[model samples]
Target: MSLGGRGDLTARIYRQIRDAVLDGRLRAGERLPSTREPAGRLGVSRDPAGHAGLREAIARHAGVARSVRAGADDVIVTQGAQQALDLVGRVMVGPGDLVAVEEPGYPPARLLFRSLGARVTGVPVDDEGIDVAAIPDAARLVYVTPSHQFPLGVPMSPARRTALLAWAERRDAVVVEDDYDSEFRFGARSLEPLQSLDRAGRVVYVGSFSKTLLPALRLGFLVAPASLRAALHAAKRLTDWHGDLLTQAALARFMEEGLLARHVRRATRE
Candidate 1:
């Protein structure tokens, strides 16, 4: 490849490694040597050696746009919302941490927390959502699907929502709001997230675009208190440097243009 053509070659290599990581060929926590070292080791030129600028290029390619405003500092992009949850589990819950979850919540959330050494406590759910009174004081993190409980199509009631938030605050516990299908509440104005009520910094809200967009998009964000955002971001960086650059770019574009909201609207209407 010529000097100018090296740009295209670099993109290819970026995608190759990125795909490997995403595809399970390269598992999380696997170390990757310097790009140049890999190129040299593979008998290739340095054309594919520089990845410093690859992140931005990939972010743009993935339709992500950058912005600053309400809840900006707290959001960290991840491979997907699943990884975001995993990151939350890793950084927020230590061994034996009590995790309160909806009785019939997303199976993955419970499993992930358990995998991280958390003691999962199942709280009964109703149309109103997870019962706050049932929550154990030992729980450090309360994982709930407030907008809509998974598979049950249950949206937690207003009173229950308020009570849940208050419960989290009174205990100084962290609430991980899985706003997974929030965009699909359908026909009425969307309900405010539980995180919105968190003035005491006890809520760690999460959002994912996997449902509205393609599953392969693997895009999501976590809105937490400023104090914990840095730790979560550090965990994110350690997990995947900065997530898929191109995917982040594509999602940013989707967010910046309001296309994402439109798509969600259309889906909800249909």
Candidate 2:
């Protein structure tokens, strides 16, 4: 029988034995090993946890390359940028909380916010990015792809970026800056990241290796404010315990050895 089949049988047998013992049908000195012992023998374990090395590497890269000041403590390794979004939605968004997203934005983000009971509002986007003036006054959270607006490919202008941050501060709102494709710039100088421009701790920067390296890797991270770091880590732990350890370790080595930078340079030139 397959391993799964054997596991099922073992569980059934263990339950039966427990019931027999409770009913005084089995002897006190039973020879059966505990369920955990057998599971351990089978090499099953809890979900993979995030690696510290990878988190540190990510913090270093973001600080050095993207001008985002993130420490390992402020980073949460997620399955991808999508999960980072989900985590933010879970922790920060409450029922009926207003969430403003770009109007033709990434569909998954809108759906995810809605699933968490947020009243997601679509704000129109133009060449300058999501129009800050159009954001609802009651919005508690704003999600934007400012580095390179999704699908439309327009970078959020510097003036608009400042306005958005100011609006977030005035409204007591949080801004989720999805820096998904900022690493591969074509010609123009990269605009300062919203997180870097943020002085009021309102921006949560989300990044993914999917666009830069490979989507199959499903590796991404969130650079949250010091205040939100604990809650984000708790949310991450509840959702998936952590991300894949092997992939994180490998990616950490790739980053530390400068392999990722080299690859990006080569790929951008091509």
Q: Compute each candidate's TM-score over C-alphas.
A: 0.72, 0.81
**The best candidate in terms of TM-score:** 2
Off by over 4 Å in 2: 1-49
Worst 10 residues of 2 by lDDT: 1-10
lDDT of each: 0.68, 0.84
Q: How close is candidate 1 to the true structure, as a TM-score?
A: 0.72
For candidate 2, give the lDDT of residue 128. Answer: 95
Off by over 4 Å in 1: 1-69
State in Å the error of residue 71, model 2: 1.4
For 1-270, candidate 2 gives per-residue lDDT tens digits of 222233333344556667878898777886765656645655433222266667778999988779998887778888999999999999899999999999889999999999999999999999999999999999999999998898798999999999999999999889999999878887776887999989999999999999889999999999999888778877887888866776776787788788888898888888
Per-residue C-alpha lDDT of model 1 across residues 53-172, encoded as one tens digit per residue: 332332332222222123333456666678878988988899988998888878988999999999998999877778899999888998888877876767788999889878877887
Candidate 2, overall lDDT? 0.84
Per-candidate count of clashing residue pairs (backbone under 3 Å): 22, 0
